[model samples]
Target: MPSPRLPEASFPLHLPHVWSGSEMGAQEGICAPSTHACLDAQLPGNGWPVGGVVEVLQAQPEDHVWRLLLPALGQAVQAHAGPVVLINAPREPFGPGLKAHGLPAERLLSIHADKPSARVWATEQALRCADVAAVLAWLPQVKSAELRRLHLASHQQERMFFVFRPLHVQADASPARLRVMVEGHEALKVHILKRRGPPLASPVLLAAQTGRLAELLQARKGRAAPPQAALPVKPITPTPSLAHLATAAIKGPAPGQQKIKEESNVERIASALDRIALPG
Candidate 1:
């Protein structure tokens, strides 16, 4: 007779560090986007935080960085969550590139504020708009205190905000819920510099259909990227929920902001917002 087989055993504790997110459970309030399963598996919430800030550090400017985030942002837009906003963008908002990625043209808005102070001010305002699906700002000179303020604003409105800093500032301290260092031409490599539960020990590869990347792979790619557009300075009024108007989400970051106001001589920031008004 065959030797008695050992009964199957389950080791609740023994798992890859990558698998640790599962133990944290649904209560952790993690919003892991399925587009990045590996990353979601490593995040505390099993994904990006639903209403938190994610800081991305990149060496050069390219649409690849946006592609890394498009999956999540596109998902939020498709859900009718809100429009995607970019403040002080370095390049023009190429309509073709955005449309190919599934982001609706009408829901796109851009704000151009070159001054660091002005950019920070505009970012705060965009976050206060509760219906905004996501906010992307290129703020290279943002100080830690301002980052903290942006963090607070994000939580208040539960909006997804992304701030880009130079790769050199990776050493500086930050208040963002998640911080990452991204580097790549086609096949992007993401280093999870900081996260909620535990620090990631390795970098995550985020692949995209970039021109250079496609050329290297000898694969057919879509039409060339569209040229970048200039950012508008006026803020467009948000859609009224029709018949009964929707409550205002344009709240300022107060309490702490009151303290900041006393210290800085920054003027109130206002910008033109764009959204195709819908029929009531």
Candidate 2:
């Protein structure tokens, strides 16, 4: 038996749904929570945007931020199946600390570029690569246009891109979806200076494990420090004798004895020259 066929409904191939604050849309600011629940509550979308550029402004850039990011970054690496990339890191990463935090050595990659231009170039390139789970670049100075370009490149891959700039840039305008100042303290202090949502007034605090940090320090304390390469032995600079200085200070040809000594030196030099064999 043939059932009655319903009329077919056709929909457009590409329907761009423009959105507003009223209607709930997936395209809106949907965020994953930060590693810390308190911080997540403060941030827009409940947390930082997963697929946007985040500009991290700090007075100093050290691995301390990694503690706050450990939870989020661990998930990101697992989700994306890519290693976290670091560009122009200030110092070599402490491997034991990372291991203690649950991030393996294989999951991390550090690119050392001394020059600012090289660092910028490497940072941009790293941001564009979809294979990278996240990129942390320390950019002390950069143009707004260059940052915009980085923002564009960052979004293309839909991976997290973090540029660590000076805290002074907190006043400067940027194109990143999230801009926060990460300051070092007993606890990790983070303040969202800029974002797409309501203004944030207070800073978020993430606890630091003093015990684990101390234990790590203790463990490393036993290992012998890297033998510093021996510095070049400087030629011994002999102290000038008082006699030589006194002799030099005396008015030259006025002393007959000194004049005679000068003539003797000239004769010695001439005799030495005469003794030398000349080329035919």
Candidate 3:
């Protein structure tokens, strides 16, 4: 005989740390919502894990990071009242673009480091800082051990930590609590590489832009194109040929003059014939 199963509500009360493999894990603590409803739904906490390393793998380094992280960074800035630190960012943050995403221009702190070790160290230190709400590091060649260090530091400080690495490293071991591969196309495709629940079979397709950028794109799409200027056409006049001119000159004179000219021509022809002599 089979034993009776316990109620679903009793699990949390009895096994707080335990969660079935098929379902998403409970929130570790407070989390930063991803802002994208579709993406948030797939996450274990229904958002970014506040105290764990989140690894983002992409074909290119700087292409889609801003589009994916902007919303969460904006919320992080508001919640922590601290600057969002960027470690070894591929490019300098655009002030207006960040502002347009609802992330304050003044709240961004950019750090540049050429060495991979220096980048890793900076990321760890930033994670430890109480004033830093989030830390984004671009470490294309960082080792798993260095990542483990950052992950440990993140747990101690409890903040939003994202590490950007090349897609080639997906096969390598990682300490990130959540790992997602971002493929850029008409839309951003986020494939869940690692998660607390069952592996996601399909990637989540998200719009490439949102907020003011999305609005601007939608407005531009709705706008009508300006009418093209019509070219001015000139009237064409045909030139008279030599034959036409000569015929016109001959016939255009008065009728009396025309008759006299014809008679003179006939007389000249008759004189030439007489001068040649008769054939008889």
Candidate 4:
């Protein structure tokens, strides 16, 4: 006999069963916080649903469409430690305006692309970058397939993506998790065009001047002091002319003539004032 056969029962091994849900939930929860905290709380995975697309529709440039998305973008930036990329396709995004909305200048990277294809490519690259937390693309039009591609890329990179499209394109079906149409008002109003969960057709009102995140942060920064009243300035009257004085003393001119002279003098005084550079 070359060797002795080992007993199969004696060689039995005990292995621990691993739970998938517990592991997945732990990982997902760590990456994406509670979805309820997000705008509308209708996104999947309790957040903006990473890897999915979000389309922002604007009636016009002045509609403050970006302000409407600020809440979600700001929250995502705060939650994730990565840069936020904004790709401008048609028009340049007001960087200072974004700063005023509470997105710090240091955290934002803006790219101006001349063409729509370039914008989409640049947006995709930004989304794929590990350093980027979110990518916002301002494109004129986006097809469903392009959105699907972005969604897949976002999923691969685990980043949030938003596209600002013209109002005309909002009616088109997309791969976006949420499609919002932003219209201007005294405050910004968001009409949910499509969503994955409940709260469909709900309109959310947000301050037009300041974003929801900015408002909350400003409230915490402390109240603004009452504005002080401006001091009243005294009006200065020009001295009467010698002719008027003589006329007053001698009663030389008729009432109508005096009125005409006064009008003439007023025109002269106005001309003189126009040439003078008065100190503030």
Q: Which candidate is the best by TM-score?
A: 3
Q: What is the C-alpha lDDT of each candidate?
A: 0.64, 0.61, 0.69, 0.54
Model 3 — which ten-residue stretch has the worst lDDT?
271-280
Q: How many backbone clashes does every candidate have?
A: 13, 0, 0, 1
Best lDDT among the predictions, by candidate number = 3
Candidate 1 per-residue lDDT, tens place, 29-56, comes to 4373736776667666666776667888
Looking at candidate 2, the ten consecutive residues that score lowest on lDDT are 271-280
lDDT of 4 by residue, 162-258 (tens): 7787788855778766677777655766676765444445676655354654564456348554542422323333223322322232232344432
Question: What RMSD, rounded to one decimal, does every model reach?
Answer: 9.4, 22.0, 35.3, 23.8
lDDT by residue for model 3 over 1-280, one digit each (tens)? Answer: 8999988877554367677787777867767778889999999888888888999998887545677888888888777755577776786555556778777655555555445665676566568776667888888989888889899999888879998888899999898989999987547899999987888999999986756676654554586655423223232221232223223222333444222123233443222212211112
Once superposed on the true structure, which residue ranges of model 1 sit more than 4 Å away at CA? 1-27, 30-34, 208-280
Clashing residue pairs in candidate 4 are 35-46
Tens digits of lDDT, candidate 2, 1-280: 9997765555343344443333322333445556578887666666667666788887877667766666666666666645576766686556677766656554555655444655666566567655567777778877788788888887776767778888777778888877888876557788877665556668877786569875775676677667434223232221232122123222123433222122334443222222222112
Candidate 4 residue-wise lDDT at 135: 79
Whole-structure CA lDDT of model 1: 0.64
Candidate 4 vs. true structure, TM-score: 0.55
